[model samples]
Each structure stands twice: as C-alpha cells, then as structure tokens.
Target: MLRQLGSGAQYLATDINQHAAETTQATLEAHGVHADVIVTDIMSGLDKRLAGMVDVAVVNPPYVPTHVEEVGCRGIAASWAVGLNGRQVIDRILPAVREMLSERGWLYMVALEDNDPSDICHLMSEMGNLREMFQIDAADYMMSICGDDSLKELSSPGKSGSIFYLSQDERFVIKTLRKTELKILLKLLPKYYNHVRAYDNTLITNFFWRPQDYSERRKKGSLCCDEKYVLH
Candidate 1:
C-alpha cells in the first residue's frame, strides 16, 4: 500500500529474520516495485543514513505476548513472540522510529488492544516533543476554523458523553459537545478568545473554532457541535 500510495518516495524495510527480508524483497519485485530491504533488528545499522530524514514510517512488529526466550528465536516463532506485555519489540522500535522521523514525519503502527496503544501514544507524544508539535499559531488557528479535514476521529463515547478526534498532524484535538455545553461555550467564547489572545502564557485551553454544526441535512435530531482544541 505504501508503494502504491507513496510514488517516487524512497522505501526501506527491515526485518530481523533474513527470510522475511527476502520475502519482502520478492513481494516488491513481483509487483514491479523496488525498495531496499535489509535483514536487521528494526532500523538497526541504517540509523546513520536515515536518521531524522524518514518522512513516513509503517511498523507491524511482533505483538503477541510469549515467553522471553521465544523473542529472538529463529524461524516462524520469532514473528509473534513478543515478551511479556507484547511490547518488547514495540518498545524498542518506538525510540528508533522517533529518531528517524523528520519534523513533519508521520508513523503508522499496528497494535493490539492488549498492547496498551493509548500509553504508546502518550509515550510518543512526550518523546516527539508534543508541545512543539501541537503548538498552534494564529495562521494555524484560522485554517482549522475554516473547516480543515485534518481532524480525524480519535475515539468516541467517552465518560463525558463526547467523541474525540485528533488532527492528522496531531496538532489539534476535536471534541463533540452536547447542546447545553455548546451553549455555555458559545456564551463565553468572546471573552475566552480575548483572554487567550492577550496572554501568551495563559494556562487556558486554546479553542480555535466555535461550535460547528455537523448534522446531516436530512437528520431530524439536534445538530452535533464539534469543538476544536489546540494544545499550546
């Protein structure tokens, strides 16, 4: 899929197992695609060449919890033998990938529910310096308010009865609001915006947009308001 979507981009794939690397190379060749495939433990040895230069990365590491001894074993068992919380390989891969990512780089990783994906996200946020990544300036605020499609659904049906979404660049969070909440927010929006604009070091959440009605034209129910939150 990366080959299909990312035309003209340099592609590099790594596997600890030599056979797996060869298989990946064969698959690419069969499809008339060319990519560099290496037999190494997740981005090893290529760090010097690719560090802080990778634009996009996709990882499908071994995530099945098994005995520690099975982790580095040869053949098929090595594919799914993640030690303990299914994060042995995943934990190692995260930092390496972090270092390889450019400022605008994006990572797509496969994780099971048991692997605690949420915690992984938090870890990446900290490692990637989310304060800088999520910082919203005046121009960014205007663009987001003008109906940017970067806001993709993150999660839904939270304890607050709201749906949460994160921007594609992970710069902003969009949260659905209830009718009553929207009314209160609308009432204070002017004052809130003024205060935030006046004080650069304010601790208040930076709200980029007012409530946006997202109800379908044919829908008979109340309009759903999506509130955009920029963490600055």
Candidate 2:
C-alpha cells in the first residue's frame, strides 16, 4: 500500500474519475505520498495504457449490478462490478491482467457467493505463475452495511430488502442479510465508525467457523470485492 510500500519514493494510483483522482492525490500529498496518479477513464482501452509490467495489483471490484447512478454514490473507476450472472467485466480485463503479470505477479481477487462460475474460476485459476495458495469464505462483507441506519429500512418486515431477485442488469440482488451474512457482519463490521446491530436475519443454518478460516484474509490487500457503499 502507499502507506507501507510507498516509503517516500514513487507510486501510482489510478482512478477513472478526475475528481476522485485529484482528491486522492491531495490526500496522498497530505500524507506525503509522492506518487503518480492517473485520472484517465480506464474503461476505454485501458489495457493499452497498462499493458504489462505490473508486479502486483490489489483490486476490490464493485458489487453493484451496473452503471445506474445512485442518488449520491460515485461509481468505481472501471465498470468492474461484473453482474452476478455475467462475466463481461472480468472478460474485458482478465486476459490482459493475466498477460500483464511479471510471471510472478498474482491477482488476489475476492469471490462473492453470487459470482458466476466462470468469473470465480478465472479469478482463481493458475495464472502467471500464481496458483491458489488458499481460500476462505471471508466474513460476508456485503451484509455488514445493514447495521447502518440508512440501510436499516431495507430490513423492515415485508420490505423487499432481504429478498433475492435478479437485477435488471442480470446480477443477483440479495438485499438483506441472511444467517451466514449476519454471523460474519456482526463479527467483522464493528471496526467501522458508527456501526451498530440492525435487523437479525432470523434464518438458521448448521454452520461453524474457525479462526484459521479467517486468518487467510487480507483486509488491506487489493483484488477483493470492491463494493464499499455500493449496495443499497
């Protein structure tokens, strides 16, 4: 990360949004990160600008279904939030990503339960000298947002929030928390500022978890689900 690896030298941060890029640049400068930041739209011929030479990359792809604008939310750099039912986004850049690796680089991507089979496999297959070292179902990060007041209404009785339906964009829309989701959300979400328990899923399953199961996680690492603040 810029904080640890930056070491007062050079680094690069890219975001499609000019505003976000500039804002990140300012924040980096404030923190003394003398790095290059690219604000170009990565969606349009992005692989060309960044063909290869990457040693490592940490990315958190968005979770939302598509390009519809939320009332106040800004979108991620690329339309990287491939719909749960399709593999377009991954299809666009995955091959290029595989080719871009230094033969030692590994793409540490997250696999959401809703992710399509092809995407998940492609996300983990032996690529550029990288084999899956480990895998653990991470705490259900999507359901963690339920604790926020703004999201509480999605849990109200009879609300369609928790219901699973297909989005117009063909992604599975799991609105509310389920038992497994609650189990993880309650466990990992307290670190965020102002988080509190909201609705309990009430659904049950004969499930068990181990500490070592979660030890494999890299919270600060990239290539995980990037759906921060994107879920309704």
Candidate 3:
C-alpha cells in the first residue's frame, strides 16, 4: 500500500523506532521507490503541516492486550505492547487522526477484539462533524448472516508473535497462527468440539485459509496477503 502511494504521492513513513524507520527506507529503496522515513511517535512533529491535507490514513496500531505499565516500551516490544484492552495507543490515535485528516479523508484501521472496535467506530463517528458521514461497516458472518450485532468472545491466546483480529461484528476471531500452533489447533478440534457440545457454548466457529492468488484482488486494489488462516 505504501509502495503504491509513494510512487505518485508525497509519502512519509514514521515510526517510533529509529531502526524501523531506517528499515522502511531501505525497503522502499530496494523497491526503487522514494519516501521520507522518519522516527517519531505517531504524527508528533508533522501534525501542523499535514493537518487537513491528508487524503487517507492507514494504521495497524499496537492492539495486543498487555499490562498497563508496558504500554510504551522500548525496542521491538513497543510494536505490540499495548496497555489494558489494547486501547491505550489506539485511543490516543483517534484524536490525532481527526486532526490530520481532510474533510474528504477516510481512515482505515485494524483492531483486535481487545481494542473494542464498535466503541472505536462510535467514538470516531461522534467526533466533530463526522457523525453524519461516518458509519461502521464490518466484514464478518454476523454482519452477513444475522444482520444484527450479535458477537461473542473467547479467552485470548496471548502469544507475543501471533497476530489476532476479530470479525467485524466480533462473532469470531481470526488469528495468524504459526505452523506449529496451527498443527496443535488442528489436533485439538475434536476435543474442542466435544467440549463445546457439552457446554453448549462456543465462540470458535470457522477456520480456513484465504486464497492467495492476487490476480482478482489486484483488480480491486492493492494485494494484501499477510495472513494464512481465517479462524473464528
């Protein structure tokens, strides 16, 4: 996404980690593209100049649930060490997004169940003049099948390297499980099924791999093939 935008626009990549910023620069260079990669906490220094000028804002923030004291840590840990409910950093980002976006701008953010996405959308909708124009659209079975906001949650599998996301209506969680973890999950399905049957309660619903052929998706927009499973 950044690569495509950088080709035709004034693309700037900012990160709190200096190493991350440098790495992004190197990646862009390797791709034969150019961008200003800066090390800054969010949009700290660039706010004033960029305010009301941004057309799109894309964020994949720190949405991992963690201890309150670990919210703003140093090094690579900072990438995922979000405070309680994973909302500390995400909550802060809303106001910054409002300040930086133009009247015609739109924000695309990725959030986990711990981040409370519905609440995030509601809060953003209520911000300034956005209430009339902004609405939440979730991509999930609940939204597609039930057409009502019925969602559920299961215990979080707190693994540092894993990435987790909830369906739009929060009916199911989608995790990027490692190969070994995927193997374990496949082995546990029968036990999980019997346990759920015994209790008559479950948040786990479906699991499958997303097709990685980007030919069709490329017609729609950029191709994002980062995940391997669609677990619910």
Q: Count the backbone clashes (under 3 Å) in each candidate.
A: 0, 7, 1
Query: What's the lDDT of the predicted structure labeled candidate 1?
Result: 0.66
- Indicate whether candidate 1 or candidate 3 has the larger lDDT: 1
The TM-score values for the models, in the order shown, are: 0.54, 0.40, 0.53
Better of 1 and 2 by TM-score: 1
| lDDT tens digits, residue span 1-232, model 1 | 7557667788889997888899999999898778989887676556546756889999999998888788768789988998877976776677567767877899999999889898777666554442233363434543443333656766656777677777666766777776457546644644665575577788877554423334431154432433323222
Provide the RMSD of all predictions against the true structure, rounded to 1 decimal: 18.4, 17.9, 18.0
- 1 against 3, candidate with superior TM-score: 1
User: Per-residue lDDT for 1-232 in model 2, tens only?
Assistant: 5677747444666665787789978998898668677864332333334434567765544434543333124465344444433343343345445544554666655445555545355333432222111221122321232121212222232442343222343322334343345435423422321121222242322111110111112254521222211122
Q: What's model 3's lDDT at 80? A: 91
Residue-level lDDT of model 3, residues 1-232, one tens digit each, is 6566555677777887888888889998898778788887677656546656778888888889988787657878899997778876676577567656777889999999777798787656544232222232222221321211332323444544444555555545555545445446534644654554455344655332221112333355532333233344
Off by over 4 Å in 1: 1-7, 130-232
**What is the TM-score (0 to 1) of candidate 1?**
0.54
Q: Which ranges of candidate 2 are over 4 A from the true structure?
A: 1-3, 6-10, 43-50, 66-87, 123-232
Overall lDDT per candidate, in order of appearance: 0.66, 0.39, 0.58
Candidate 3, position 48, lDDT? 48
